[model samples]
Target: MNRRQMTFIILVNALVSLLIVLLVTWIVELRRPDPEELAALYTPAPAVLLAPTVTVPVETLPVVGGDAQATPDTGTTQAEGDETVYVVQAGDSLLGVAARFGVTIDDLVQTNNLANPDFVFSGQRLIIPATGQTASPNATTQPAAPGEPQIVAVESAGNLADEAVLIVNESDNPASLAGWRLEREGGPTYTFGNVQLFAGSSIRVYSTSGEDNTIALYWGQLDPVWRAGAVVRLLDGDGVEMMRQVIP
Candidate 1:
């Protein structure tokens, strides 16, 4: 072949090689991910978590507003079918008084905000916070007058709706009882709002009128809110039992 023809062929090959290299470089640049797009794909996002429910014991809760004085018995009677029932008697323990109304011990303590707890006396009136009942307090209280009812009683006559309900027999003469609802169950006595009942905490129970004379006194559980069926150490608040059920 002539030298000129060979040179022409070589030149054509060199140009083709250059074009191929440029095409490959362009394809590589296009295939790389954009920095902005990469950031959007890998950016971190915020997360959210749910809070557990909590129930504040009446005693532990701080008083916000209203009459800070002890709940008073205005020398009035709790007539039949009244929304708030009254228990008139001097020197009655919270548990004993509540039993007559088929309530739980914690209900009375929480409703009344008994500070000493061991020291409730006559003429001290209490507000029944809730029928289902959640409980009380540790502030200073003045001494009571002589012959005043020890505890102003309230009632908790209802079914045990899986909520540690107080079962009362408006006239039944004997009944049994347990203290402290499971925290998860959230009984009215230990649960003020929607908080869960805590385990291993002190709780009280009341008997049904005419239905709970078994011990003739109050019974307390030092720590049993974890599970309802388990029995725990018991004590008498002033007196934690029922002497007899009286019709109101």
Candidate 2:
């Protein structure tokens, strides 16, 4: 072949190689992904956490008024009925205390078994009944004399046969046993009918029901009247407390 023809063929081959390289580079650029799009696809989502449940307890409280001395008795319960215990202040009287709680003076006398009704000492405990209850007065009950009936013995625990309460009169003059009462704190009460106790003499009060005589009296009770280690109170004719005897 001629020299000019050989040079033209070499130039055509070089141009063809350059065009093929450019086409391959353009295809590689088009296949590559954007940086923002890669971050949205590969990034992980945030985690969520939850908390636990809990419980709480509540308590109750009593309501108080202005006067501290005049707190209501809403927490005490008695065997006779629902009652409130009150403390007597320095200048407190049965009538005034009754008025404060909207009760009658007779209620205070009957509840506390006041012998003189007019005499009350400071720091003494008194029971005041709830509203709307009338205390019945014993007409035969008399005012208590200073010292007449004495409690000598108290036998509270016997099975209806041997339970007895012994009482004596150590006074100089004779005293009537009529309307006198022998009672337990939350239990039985016995009232004398028509009997006279001579000076320096003694009598026995039985628990079971039977005939009442001069020396022996029947309480007319079937159930147990009192328990051991209990106190028996002796009240005079006027419902005044005279003595207390504890069972052995």
Top-lDDT candidate index: 2
TM-scores vs. true structure, each candidate: 0.25, 0.40
lDDT minimum window of 10 residues, candidate 1 = 134-143
- Which residue segments of model 2 deviate by more than 4 Å? 1-146
Residue-by-residue lDDT tens digits, candidate 2, 27-144: 9888999888999899687877677677676775554664546545342235345557777787766655664454455567887889987788877778876643211221122323
142: Cα error in model 2, Å: 21
Tens digits of per-residue lDDT for model 1, 61-131: 66657658556555446544564645546745555566545456666667677676556656666555435
lDDT for model 1: 0.40
The models' CA-based lDDT, in order, is 0.40, 0.68
The TM-score of candidate 2 is: 0.40
TM-score of 1: 0.25
